[model samples]
Target chain A: DPQLHEYMKLDKKYRSIGFLSARTGGAPHVMAADEAVKATNTEVVSIEMARDTKGGAGHGATIIFAAEDVSDARRAVEITLEAVEKNFGNVYSSDAGHIELHYTARASMALEKGFNALVGKSFGIIVGAPAAIGLVMADTAVKTANVDVVTYASPNNGTARSNEIIISITGDSGAVKQSLLAAQEVGLSVLSSMGEIPKSGSTPTLI
Target chain B: DPQLHEYMKLDKKYRSIGFLSARTGGAPHVMAADEAVKATNTEVVSIEMARDTKGGAGHGATIIFAAEDVSDARRAVEITLEAVEKNFGNVYSSDAGHIELHYTARASMALEKGFNALVGKSFGIIVGAPAAIGLVMADTAVKTANVDVVTYASPNNGTARSNEIIISITGDSGAVKQSLLAAQEVGLSVLSSMGEIPKSGSTPTLI
Candidate 1:
């Protein structure tokens, strides 16, 4: 509880935030992250290298920054982008595709939650498909075990066409393992059935 | 700084984290979020309503939670999933297709960055396409104004096929506006040229 209290206080301090994501990874990504930090008076929150399930490679990296205000955060993002382009223009094509910037006037619940999860002691994750199937999996996972549901999302990890879904849970190691197993059963079933769906001619063909 | 100190303390407290995302919105999503909280000794991190950019509709919501340990977090996720399914089976298909869960053993840099961005004062965003084109746009935005680039991504908003890219920046109202305008010019250019590409005869034909 005291920690939670501290978190709340921290949440209030950096009322501005910024997120940068690139589709490619490696040196450019690292350089960009560094530039962002140097560009403004902000703290680096995260630097994540996203996996590419389809290509079986590193898809990209997402960098997050916390700034004292929106202006500083914005400056950081701009500096990083420019710096990345200047240093690694060629890599830009593969890495610098999806870029997003969002700012809030107050503490963001989503960010706080993400931070809490990051500092957590234990965690579990489940990835599946067909959004609907994932829900079923999550339901089973929770029902069969004593765990906490962190979050779930569709088409995560750059598997947009795959329709894959992901579910995350946290708890004691035993509970997490039990929950994951239960969820895996559901995920595997869905994955197997996915291939069984009879080809429907009605599927739209993009011209 | 005091707030940040508090945040660090709080971050140390919750060593386990979890996340759950549902594709459907409204009652089912809300119900699941509530259930997860009630089922465990965890803190709610975020509840987000996703926007369906491609389909032009509401995608659903995502819930994040923090717990004292992994076991509690896992339990929370499980409870929430079951409750949502029991109450809204039909909505599950539309909203629950994408489910994901994740856990961490220690502090997560990514989560912290996300939190910082979320709490920022003000921000700007740009969504473009073809990863490379997005980079060009990012360059233009930074070069044209005194804005900070928060983040950017390719084929954003779940449109893996669409190849749409998104970019975000933050700064003073004037700078944000200027940066967005500059980026928009690049985005429009890319969008316009997208249709002029000659179709290849060898394009795969799905039966």
Candidate 2:
């Protein structure tokens, strides 16, 4: 009975699980998820736009499917993917503006766990308005200097404004600093040139 | 002894709790929290920006404190409030653009819990990007029709992009439709006149 109980508990969690991370994340998966369920006898476990997309460097959403058999789980994932083939999300970084930076030479224990994995390491915080900016910043930081994006949050799961993206990149002190500067500089330059209004004032001035 | 154990468990939850919902919500409470802990013998329970600031129709944040005694908890809340008095958060709502709408006359049980309180009411959804639009839309809806703001979510705790705000208002079907149209019309007119760009494409081009 004890063994059966354990097995039953584990079984209830699901016998098989399949995952699909779309190219860019969004909530349209609900529509595609319906098609997935209708085509296969599987349950959609979770579906949401990811705080960070594009393999953790861009914007996108993810979905998980569970079933009693591996075939059913796999089929569900495949159907969802096919259903969304024509329309998927993408990180539109070029529209980003309102950049903010907070860099730490050495993270202390007082920092939130979002930065906990970065203790003792140097990290740079770059916030971009219009979440798409994270993709551009992440790409810029990693390419400009040897840094890894430790945290990527969009409005989907981050505390930023719905149009904002928060990126935390970590590396050696020198690299982090360099990466942050490059990312911030590039973001401001491009955004400003495009006439992005500053993040203050209520009405957009006709200027 | 059993009763004593129950009492101890309750004590761990805190003998007293004090709450302070700021006019707006954001993560800046971390700084105020530091000052509160330094000045009082209470624990800062939770602090964050609310999805809907200004009493569910505006933008803001909230903070909670707990302590072993009522006096300690109240003092912690006061200290935190006092520390943030000069720089409490506020919803910057005039900078909204990129709007989408989804309305439902009747809700099925499958709807997200955010709409549960509104399941039986005629609901109109208005989404504005940059998280500031919710304030304007919420204000307009209430003033234009006999409706109540049922759900308010921003990038802080919503599924929107960091710059988006989602507001759901409920009323009689006619009222819901009228309010939605009025709010939507006002938003589009003002935003468009301000040269608010559409939500497609990557870069903002000079018109």
Candidate 3:
């Protein structure tokens, strides 16, 4: 849509804005967005799947939430992250996929706003999934590790059904490591549950 | 990715720019970009798969071609389109898919830049399969029918493996009709060749 220049600013009441990009399933992305809005006092400012060349969910889904309080915004984002963290990369089919999650506690180089939104922080790389897994990962990384995204293809978005998602974040090397660890932990549990229903008697809450 | 705020000025010599987005397989997207550059006097400016969530090709792939001559740029885009047009939606497997192609010669509403880069041109829609078919369709429509795209989804990107692609273009009803017909014709030939070798002793040239 070429109305790319169209814009509006929220009043001071909506001074804080939270964004979530579930780079994976539309099912998960929509669900996460729904949960975020329902679980918090945030308003859905914009929500839509990507309309890239193929149009429609070509790039998965993105949601923006606005709140009067930054904490509320942050919390809403965290909720979305957790939702995506758990849902996006899971393989519900008979266990047929590999989950390659890595944990790095230290990094050497720093980057600027390279990941989804990380800035001036050395980054860690994220790769996993069937589609659009990077967005949700960033949502989680920012919340859990206080890192900024360095960025790139959520991974294998180019490869038809590469089943790999990748994301990079920047922060103190420790934060980058934490971000990677946090995402990898969730990835293992979710991807490991392929074809098996992991009991979720309790509603998913942001950690 | 946040350096989105950065800017550049193309020299007058490179005033013409062509962009191609193959919202489907990374293989096809890269091939198309390569073919575009090889086939014409255009320079590659940027090329990458989507990084929406899982990052890396989350949205397929996009390539930019810059040329001093408008024809070169347009031709480059057309070649990319033709390349994508032929490659993206094919099912090199036994025909197990349905090809739903529609032709609408008359459009009811006017839109402004709704599809790809189409401006208030009263659009026609395109939808077809595996991934990002809409983009290559737009490239064809713009070149062949002189129509603009009225957008919203290549379709089914949000849905995991829905195998659907959609895009809309705007123009005179006649042009819209032509665009649809042309795309449908191509889609039928390409998709119908599923799992079979359609002899292509002759290279694909823009019609």
Candidate 4:
């Protein structure tokens, strides 16, 4: 797990979106998110002009927030996004346009670190369960060692068990299909190893 | 606009994710581009178990496709998510174990129509230019009659000196801020206008 500590060292943040409703004559302002707001650095707000006129009743606004810590910000973003969409049916279009910001603190740190990482690096891909030792080491290698790295994971990594982790990667159609197959392999292996499957379930799964 | 006629209808044949790839591989197999696939789609795909470990020489494969399409697919899932952040390095944890196939379609003629129309739709978005009545009617009102429609152009709509429409929706933090504000207020007004802006840009510009 300590190996994973290195991978986790990279600064990460979460984001959220929400819609705020004006109470009759009430002014338009973001609803208080309480501790969650403090935890995440929320920013960028948009009002759903469509919802603001339903029955010509009240005004609605959509807010986009970015937070400092990741898990908190991610939760905030989810809550905001869901709330706005549920309240405004027409809130789904990217046509409305979006604005994203990299705050000074985060931007400065990334610049300081990114350039150093870039200077001495060569291209390479990081494969395995994202939490695996190999991946963490590869991330570390890519960072401090000037190695360009790409990280990936399989369904076998118990990803199906938790919603806490999010993985992002790039691959071709063949690579994607293979990734799906690999995930299947990992999942089956886990099921059998855990004795959740009957001996009959062991039809000798295919590669 | 006739090019976009087919997409207006609900079609089932256009349901494969690996459509092109399947053809290229000479494999007739097609995976349903169901809700689950859409939910799981990402800009990056990683297949850790299928890694070709030749001592890190071509150890991994990275393929970059059109970022716009990738962004579009991702937006479908995230819906109204705001401030999306992808660090230079982060693992794309997978959930193949929990994969589910909730929707399916083998093939159909209707899908081909929809695909063609969808392509045309993009073209419409580009040249319609908000001032074109035919464009606005075709876009905001025609295809999406059930939804509220709104459109606007800057330079006070008539101050521009050029024949070619220059529509600018900036993505930079500052520009994004201004554009979003304009979208919200103008959108609300349009909904209230109730077809006040003529279906045709026949009102000659004073500019």
Candidate 5:
């Protein structure tokens, strides 16, 4: 029980990065874990899988850990897989199972830092003609994202000409990057006018 | 069960990061989870704490997965915490216990990449005293570090004079900044060579 208590502390202290999948004995073993292991300066601890892929004949679970730093996080994943293979008896053994994992530092870090950056930032999009509406759709995405950017366009002089748009953004560097990327994607979407446009905007941009 | 099965699948996917802690009645609970719960995501099937913490406290249990992905992993942690909270009849209650959860991308990608980036980097040092030994020491550090540039200088003359030593280094450009910093620290250790004179350098030119 004390061991459990310590494990909980280790679990609580480190950050988790991604999920992994494996199969053992025909049963599936799916696990989500952090990038680090819990232990004293020199001790090793095992993290049990939370969601075991069961019923089909699989055994064992994938372990995940969050590294203290980027380098450490990466190392943790490698070590965990090696440990799994050792525990299950073979990397390619059908009875031993499989391991699948993913990295999301950029996405995870951005989400965490981006939300805080989003506080109070505001903006709007302008729409006039149907083509102008497309720009509006694009602008909506910028408004909701962490970056504080706004975009708009002027309608062409002709009766049915498209619009020329301008996008401007302001915020912390990371948030600004996210906003810029989002805006660019949406802007492109509208300019291309893929599929049928939505009502009003008819061609709203996807986030 | 089917709904739980679906939820479990959703939970097993994706990278998830969170923290854990102890709650009332000694139960364990997840403190925070990101993108764990969603309308169409997998539901958490159960929550189990590690029965051991190595030398600390809390419950210990591995998570078996139904599938693996970022979203599924997030859900597993969230649902486990929720279940614990429900059993304890409170949210954020201390009686349950604590376990931080983190989802990493892959096991192999965690440690080796980071380690590889740290070994065999460049180093340098400077000493203000004319101590041949100091220069020798600097050379040793440079070789040990396996770096490209190792430059150091001592005072033009020898007087056992106390002077500030400035050290600078440039090398590999591929080592971790921390490792480079370590090299710098090593250089500092040899800067004055324990006030010993060189064993083979020619006597200083008399001014």
Candidate 6:
């Protein structure tokens, strides 16, 4: 019951979670996070290494925090940023290299639980094309294998490339491999049909 | 009480909300979404135009769906993808042009309510960085203005060029503009300090 109570607390806690993720250049993520927690009354939720193959951002660090309220959350984020800035030096922000801060309200439930459920499973990823095709590919992959859909991103949100759709799935290794192969078949078919085209128009030439 | 009840329904609905987003070529976003919805048993939550400034993805389309269950969601996604593939012949998928599929589980709270609460405000965005300085800049921006951070992205996540840190803040126009100016000052200082360095190791040479 205590564990159950604690698990239920995740929902309420997630609702108020204020998140600020910063990209740090060369700073050890653990060190940066430790400094942040030491400076503020916030909890570190996750720290992800930068391995953005699509944007070629290379090795960087991402840190997330859970705070008491919106204001407190912001304060935590601010503290973390300041700590990172003090520890490291060069820092920038842009559409590509970004710092995003927000409260997910209830969105934290998916982040907290969905991620736990999906981890340790093989992953199948398909990137590129409009959303329509991406959806089909994801659907096919799920149907082909006993995989769970983790997330599907559309460019409507400024976070993603407008001309791309990214879908990730997780399952057993065999299922994941099968899903990837199935999705690739669809992707290849789309690619082969496209042939080649000029760059100046709306029709994206298959890369 | 009714409003609270309705809001609670959103959490349940969000859990079941099967989302599918697609990036289209030259096709009109509205038309594509309409067609996808007409052909599927899902509800259209949002449709976004392709305005990817970073990747030069050009005018594209993104559509979201709320489905009955995971199976239904996948089916709807599949139908939409098929429709898009039928309409747009030259589709591609790569790091830059991607297709993503995922289920947020509890993360939908952020998508549903957090975004609504944050939207319609002026935005301040900063891109390019060394990460260390970026965090400081974001902290400064938030501290300087009565603004809330929408999102902070790290170059570690692939959407950004290496060595760049991007931050976005929102509030009143005046607050947003002030935040941008504050962050800019910090960025300029970092840029000035970095000057030029050898490319052999971690010290980045300004391009």
Return the top candidate by lDDT: 2
What are the Cα lDDT values of the candidates? Answer: 0.47, 0.53, 0.48, 0.23, 0.29, 0.43
TM-score of 1: 0.32
Per-model DockQ against the true two-chain complex: 0.03, 0.01, 0.02, 0.01, 0.01, 0.06
Q: Taking the tens digit of each residue's C-alpha lDDT, what string does model 4 give over A1-207? A: 111112112223322222222211111122222222433555332211111111112222223333444565567555544433222221111211111101111111111221111211221222221233223333333333322223333333312211111122223333433433343334334334443331221122123
lDDT of 5 by residue, B32-84 (tens): 11123322243333334432333121223333323235556555555656554
Which prediction has the highest TM-score against the true structure? Answer: 3
Interface RMSD of 4: 25.5
CAPRI-style class, candidate 3: incorrect
Question: Candidate 1 vs candidate 2: which has greater DockQ?
Answer: 1
Runs with alpha carbons beyond 4 Å of true place in candidate 6 = A1-117, A152-165, A196-207, B1-135, B141-185, B189-207
Instruction: Please provide, for model 3 over A70-163, each residue's C-alpha lDDT reduced to its tens digit, 9 standing for 90 to 100.
Output: 8988998898778665654432222222332322233211111112333223545554443323333444556685665444443234323333
Q: What share of the true interface contacts does each candidate keep?
A: 0.02, 0.00, 0.02, 0.00, 0.00, 0.10
Task: Estimate, for each residue in B110-153, the C-alpha lDDT of model 3 and write its tens digit.
Answer: 11211232332344555444444445555565678777654545
lDDT of 2 by residue, A1-207 (tens): 357436434347577877777544342343455566667877665654543432222335566677889999888777767755432321123322345555656653322333343456675666554343444555577678777767665443454223445667778888888877777667666566666534421221111
- On the 0 to 100 scale, the lDDT of residue A133 in model 3 is 37
Backbone clashes in candidate 2 total: 26
- C-alpha displacement of A51 in model 2, angstroms? 17
lDDT of 5 at B83: 51
In the order shown, what is each candidate's alpha-carbon RMSD?
21.1, 24.6, 20.6, 25.7, 28.7, 19.2
Better of 2 and 4 by lDDT: 2
What TM-score quantifies how close candidate 4 is to the native fold?
A: 0.18
Q: Give the TM-score of candidate 6.
A: 0.32
Native contacts present in candidate 2, fraction: 0.00
TM-scores of chain B alone in all candidate structures, in the order given? 0.39, 0.45, 0.37, 0.21, 0.21, 0.38
DockQ of 2: 0.01
